[model samples]
Target: MEAHALYELLEKYRQGKCSPEELEQLERWYASLGKDRPDSLLEEGSEAAQVLTSRKLQELHASLGRERRVVPFRKRVLRWAAVVSGLILLAGGARYYFKPASRQGELVKEYRIPAAHSRHITLPDGSLVILHAGSRLEYPLAFNNNIRDVTLVGEAYFDIRPDTAKPFVIHSGSLRTTVLGTAFNIRAYEGSPEITVSVTRGKVKVETEQEGKLLAVLTPDQQVVYNNMGATAVRQPVTADSAIQWVRKDMVFENLSFAAVAQSISNRYHVNVRFEDEGLATCPIRASFNGTEPLETVLSVVCGIRNASYTIEDENDILITGKGCLP
Candidate 1:
């Protein structure tokens, strides 16, 4: 069927004006098109083609009438997009609705964790997430038929449910992780030097978002680190517990420099720890806290061990001064 004919039929369907014969004809055309050349529905960068594609979507929603529940308009649009996207893909159609603009109608729910705090979330798919301090996660109000996808900033630990038909996907910065069911942790704080994805169980496929290149296929006790500055990834083996200590509110420092320590402390305590002597920033410290100690106590232990002195300038800032650590 011609694009114009399809559009007219869809418009009629949307208005509930299609006769039984016309409806059957439209459905047959849809099935036939799916089998033949579904990609012809939309031409790239063509305004007229986009309009027809959008109308076809509306017609599909109207025909199904399965999504008329009490939900936000944007969410309804997203549900339709997801369903259509899956159907088209299965029919060998061009991937159209993946674009942000095409799926803009899908409502997004965002959760943010403030400094010195964390939050636990249960997704619509029964996936569990623990968002670390100063982090944010954005996901659809409900997953689409094709995929369970979410975007994260800062850090989070995920325990995704098993759904082989619809994979769970996470997007952090330029990295994307896809898994059927897995336990993993992702640290992608904006200012952090790298984005890290560590898998604790099951398997995950990590890829670069821009090029859609496979970076790694990680299994249990494995991790992939993507350097934000260089856009490079390195896969390595690690102990799962070490990678996910933050979920337990446990802080572990293993021969880490003061600067790195400060960053971790700042994230956990929501305070700025500054080094008065820049040299002290490189001092190494090895410590572990169960996250039960008060911030002041932790700081005191750290300072006393390093022969450093610290002062709380205000509620949100801490200054540290000491002689440089002996090499």
Candidate 2:
């Protein structure tokens, strides 16, 4: 089930308002969570693994209410709704895997994007991440018990969920960024000369990971570029929006047929595209867009690369004419 549905169902359970069928469904879900796993093939987000996490979470609320003299049971469970919602997403359809964490106590889940591609990620905390090509992000399987922490490689733009009590932290190479709530970008590729942190909204604090030395406190439109080898950093002002312009529909087509590109363009631009010479559909095109160009501009570039020309028959239909694929 979806996160919202799970949440509504949880509320119904807490209110003692669930029908027998709903309760039966909940039991089946829990049964699935407790399912046995193949001994040889273990992985994070596995049903058995989630059973441990879910059990711990459920136990946490109970122990708090019993031993810690915590709030009432109902109230405490209600308070845990946020945590539960995030867990539902983990079991939902996010692409991720687990790695050994620093503490060695629990595994950290990681999401990676290969070179020449980008992906959008919704963190367990509901924060948004636009991971650029050749990047990876690592975080806990569930962001429930501790502060929000993540490790980044390469680059990504983050729109963090605001939680004043718990700060969000990112470790990118030697640089560490801490913020309570903000939108920012970090570019720190391996073997790169430097790591850069740019803030678009709210405030951000940049520091050295090892020594915890303060580097810079940045506000909107500000950024810090740190020379990793030299351990020197320069803080400056910039057009923050420009830094994030790549978060748009930047895409790459590697050795793709014109017909495939046409279909993709049509899907993206909400238009129909056709070829006068069917042979032209076989032409291979390799191109990348930084995402700022308009549809016409993109099509013009694509057509030029293929030694072809295109015309707009109507606002929604495009016609292309060209010689067959050039050698």
Candidate 3:
């Protein structure tokens, strides 16, 4: 995401040598950067479009807490103009592997995991899958063109087979994750506002399923959290192993925010965690728990880390109080 690296990517894109994910990234960038700007800008030969195009660069600068200088815009705009100019071309050249409608009487296999239960199965292409509790997975009886595609309604961990010529794609809600060969986890349970993809090995490409807007290209230990309702995404480093601990019916936390950990616990135990101060919600936690541990024991350990105390109001909700992080 550095300026020089972006420039290199653009150059590679121009040469038609960029990988599938890279091209999708550039396309998504152009889409997001050009949002609500003006069609005339692109039609008018990028005089004003240049101004809108530089916003992406500026947005990156803003995120880094750097001062924006008018002096740099003039020079940077020229490099960005080429990317904006190709938006139309990218639209025309766009190719997607998804087929909206199945063939008449197509042989599709669907597996649904009940609540509080998990299931493991081998995909048609020899890929391995472990579905979390209350998850569903659907796929064709056999893959076509060496390209495997599956739809997920909840969370799943996959160990995909290597196939350079074929890409494996997973569709979850509005998020689409594409991988050539990777071990990754996708969490996209129904009615959840956020969908997450975490990679343990190899590379993965996260994108918007409807708009084909690339979200992020992730390598090992990388994760992208996409908020479907908010239409936003954040990519961050993670302990990939911890993210998929659900496969073992265990809880793993590695510098994860208290708010997130709370959600995980609530989902597993069918209880909500409430806090008075946002500070408590933001506390960083590092711990692991066996699935058999009682809920109160887990809360006790978590609160002890932050010098906090929790009192269960009922089986449905619990309250925790603390000043902030204790250590």
Candidate 4:
């Protein structure tokens, strides 16, 4: 379909003059032509048609040392104009749907993680969420007239602002964690072996709808993990000062096994650390280090303390093996 036909069809559709079947046929034709057109043709210039003509014609002209261009100048110009105008309309439509309003205050919004990195997002209600790697967080483009609600995937830590009348509820998988005015962490990695909820400050009530049970009311320095088998609550002492060290370019490892440490480091730096030594996986260590330093330096220091050896094959791959301190 050409640009004139497309514009006519669109106008008819807006006026409700096109039949359903005609509209469908027009849409199909538009999709087929749009997919085949080169993006460069969507720009204006003398070179636009010069780049898209038939390759066979180019070879023939080369052999004869003579050019036989078929496209008339007026037709070429109109086609180019249509291409540019179509691109502008498409771009404007996309921006209208995706970007937030400049001055619109407090609208429900949704955010998703397309890559590995923590996303620092401020919600419409002034609450903040630090979305961890491989996570999804969705809320309305604007919040409700009263309370604030958001859904989560993977893991996220929330630092919520106080609102007396409205409470915040985060839905993770089937579990719902609710809080009035506090900060907490929720880990619900998809198909992960466990779902964890840790609270550094304030209080949160975690509820499981499967059994209609209140699993735990977590306070500061408390955590709960729910798996298919069951849920367990642990009351452990943790420094609130460094609860979210990952966001600060630092990771706190407290008596973590080698395997667990490798996973944490991988998520923090977006790199992979593997232990080739089978025995090294179980070696335990308690450490915290700044992420600003080269990962090799941190790895060297940790391996030195644990009596292990490692080699970095490249930027993303590090092999930690050989001797490891026995637990």
lDDT of each: 0.72, 0.73, 0.70, 0.62
Better of 1 and 2 by lDDT: 2
Model 2, 212-306: lDDT tens per residue? 99999999999999998899999999887688876665356898999998876764454568899999999999998854345688899999998
Please provide, for model 3 over 19-98, each residue's C-alpha lDDT reduced to its tens digit, 9 standing for 90 to 100: 98886776555445535434532344433343335455456434322322332432343344343333323222221111
Stretches off by above 4 angstroms in model 2 are 1-98, 101-103, 249-327
Q: Estimated TM-score per prediction?
A: 0.48, 0.52, 0.46, 0.44
Instruction: Tell me model 1's lDDT, rounded to 2 decimals.
Output: 0.72
**Sorted on lDDT, highest at the top, how do the candidates line up?**
2, 1, 3, 4
What are the clashing pairs of model 4?
Answer: 107-141, 107-142, 108-140, 108-141, 108-142, 108-143, 109-140, 109-141
Cα deviation at 207, candidate 2, in Å, is 0.6
How many residue pairs clash in each candidate at the backbone level? 0, 0, 0, 8
Once superposed on the true structure, which residue ranges of model 4 sit more than 4 Å away at CA?
A: 1-108, 231-243, 250-327
Q: Candidate 3 regions off by >4 Å? A: 1-105, 250-327
Best by TM-score: 2
TM-score-wise, the better of 2 and 3 is 2
Which model is ahead, 3 or 4, in terms of TM-score? 3
Best-to-worst ranking by TM-score: 2, 1, 3, 4
Candidate 1 lDDT tens digits, 1-327: 554455456545533467988878765654453332424545566442544465565566555455544544324433343344343442232322233552454545666664476655778998888788778888876888698888898999899989989999899999999999988999998888899999999999999887899999999999999998888889999998799887656367889888888877766655668899989989898888755355687899888878998997534568999988777
